[model samples]
Target: MELRWNPILETWVMVSAQRQRRPFMPKESCPFCPGSGKVPDQYDVYLYPNDFPHLMKDPPEPSIQDDDLLRVERAFGSCDVVLYSPDHTASITQLSREHLARLFELWRDHYRAMRERADVKYVLIFENKGDIIGVTIPHPHGQIYSYPYIPARPAKELDSARRYWESHGGACLFCAVLQKELAFEKRLIWTNEHFVAFLPSYADYPNEAHIYPRRHCGSLLDMSKAEAEDFMDGLQRQVRIYDSLFGFELPFMMGFHQEPVDGAEYPYFHFHVEFYPLHRSRDKIKYNAGSETSGGAFTNPSSPEENAEELRKINAEL
Candidate 1:
């Protein structure tokens, strides 16, 4: 695998051809299953190295050279799979509150440990659920990738926040957005003491939601114990609402947006979670075609207020 820089877009493209051989929808025994000899028999939460990781700690020299237009470098990073439960059929929403809290704690621990490394610059915690979302494994799990450099999306967010702070006399960009959402209230799905889940006015995908902390924090490590518990509660409730909306497990990609681990304080950056559900409706799946992929713009079919209203009506008691 190698990282090729696209100067025009100012982003890194990872070319990992070997990942094509990874197992897809296996019919045999699950590798993540405990007692299957692939993993330990009994465990509440487990972390293991990805068998086919895109990046490595010590990658080989880049296959190509860096020119005036194109820059190439070795892909240096780490990827780990986090098992949420021992059950093969369980989902994140299905886990008990205590178990879910444990998972968040594990994520926090891994994030801190990875950021301690000299080469690590960013740590991304994310989960891709459902086969339609292209998850090769069906087990209840998430993944963490510690990169040697900050990824493009987060970098863009940081840049935006920094500019916002500079122009607005040091005000946090995300906090400002959250405040606006709260004032409007039409896009709010639900809220608790510590966090709020709402469909953003600038949502890219239908039914996409963003969860923001009530307090301004740079990352999960900054969260207090009480805030952590309330964070878990808010997350679980959001997932429950999604499942209830569709009458089944929702196919979605969820990720945490946090400050970089480059040892610099980013007071402007705010920690949050974003959920992008694949389905636009019960039987329909949203696809990113020409305009979205090539044009670098998103076309949301449904209005945020409408989607929020639909989600708000669901009973998120779980």
Candidate 2:
């Protein structure tokens, strides 16, 4: 089994065809099962390395630091699944604000701890909801992965921000985007003093939406407690809109972008959360297909402006 790294897209795609042979189970092996050796009820939070990893765990350390054309390494990182609730059936949307707030607090603590390690340079916190995204567990939870180097996507975003700062004399690029979108009022969904949720004009999905802060901030750790609360409120509201759009609980993969742990300033980087749902129509699904998978471009069936309009109307009616 070999994983091919596509330099064109800067994405490492696993080409292990044998993985398809893995058995399918009708029921999820609930990781949060009570008194189970893998998951205990006493743990509100826990961090550990992934039992199964695409990257090897014992690769040479110097290989990662090498700047040569060829690099190698053991997966000098960690992947920990977060158990968000004692009830396996509950999702974040169904969780109380208090539990969500504590989860946010735990996120901060995890990010800070991971950043302190010399080997780790980026902390990724994300959730993959629904079976469409291949979430093995039906339980409400997310995962935290600490990497030894910045991933390609974040690296690209950081470079984009840096270039924009250099060209615009330190003005934040996303701030400008938010300002212009708010003025346009076309793709705008809902916004408050602290955060704004909108569908971008260049959205690649039928109803993709993003939640970003009004003020420029490098990371979630930079946000004050009140600001974090506002973010959580905004997150819940945006998700509710998504659910309302289809009249069903929407499924999405949500992730956050924050400053790198390499100690470089990213003044132009504004923290945001993005959600990508696979559904395009009420009952139909959108496939990435050849164009998206090979061409690295997307063809959306609906316009962002229209999606925003519909979402806003639905939310208002709700």
Candidate 3:
């Protein structure tokens, strides 16, 4: 595997010939379950190295030569899997509060390790759940990827935050967004002592929701002990909200965006979690055709207010 420069989009694309060979929905055995050689027999939350990682610490030479137009480079990075539980059928909502706390700390530990690496620039914590989200393993788990450079989405967010900070006399953009959303109160799902979950007015998905720290901070390390505990509560509640929305465990792509760990200051950047659920409603999925894929513009057919209300009601009931 190697990284190829996409000049048009001004991004690096991972070219991996190995990922295609990964197992599909396996029928017989699961490496994450107990009694499997892949993991220990006893553990609540565990960190396992990805068996098939796209990037590595010391990558081999690229098979294809680099050209002036097609700039190629070694994919210097790391990917780790954070197993939430050994139970083969456990979901986020099923995990205990103490277990969830341990899982969050496991993610924090990996992030700190990757931050100290000289080759790493950004650390991303994310999870893909449900078969609709193309989850190869049904076992509940999340993954962390340390990239050699800041990813496109996080880079764009940083740029925007920096611009806002400069123009608004060192004011934070994300804080302003949270203030606006809180004032409106139409898109809000829930707000704990330290965090808030809401659907942005300009949500790209029909039922999209976001979790943001109430206090402006660069990363999870900035969170206090109480703040961190509340954050975990918000996470567990969010998953429960999604599961109760459709009366089933909903499939979604979740990612946490924070400050880049390139030994640079990012005070303007704020910590937040963005969730992109694949299904819009019961037995229906929102597909990215034409405008979303070709034109790079997302179109949400449903009303954000209505969708947010649905989740808010379910969240309150639970």
Tens digit of lDDT per residue, candidate 3, span 1-318?
Answer: 999999889999988899988888565689988898999999899998898898899987887999988999999998889899998878778877788788878888788888899999999999998787778988889998999999999999999999999999999999999999999999999999899999999999978889999999988888888998899999999999998987888889999998999999998999999999988878889999999999989999888899989888998799
Q: Which regions of candidate 3 fall more than 4 Å away from where they truly are?
A: none
What is the overall TM-score of model 2 with all chains considered together? Answer: 0.88
Rank order by TM-score, top first? 3, 1, 2
Q: What's the C-alpha lDDT at position 234 in model 1?
A: 83
Residue 199, model 1: Cα distance from true site in angstroms: 0.4
TM-score of each: 0.96, 0.88, 0.98
Per-residue lDDT of candidate 2, residues 40-143 (tens digit) = 65755455344554333343333224233333344565667777777777656676778778888888888888777776777788888888888766767788
Candidate 1 stretches greater than 4 Å from native = 316-318
- In candidate 2, list every pair of residues with a backbone clash: 56-75, 59-73, 59-74
Best by lDDT: 3
The alpha-carbon RMSD values of the candidates against the true structure, listed in the order shown, are 1.4, 3.4, 0.9
- Candidates 2 and 3 compared: the better one by lDDT is 3
lDDT of 1 at 95: 82
Q: Choose 1 or 3, whichever is better by lDDT.
A: 3
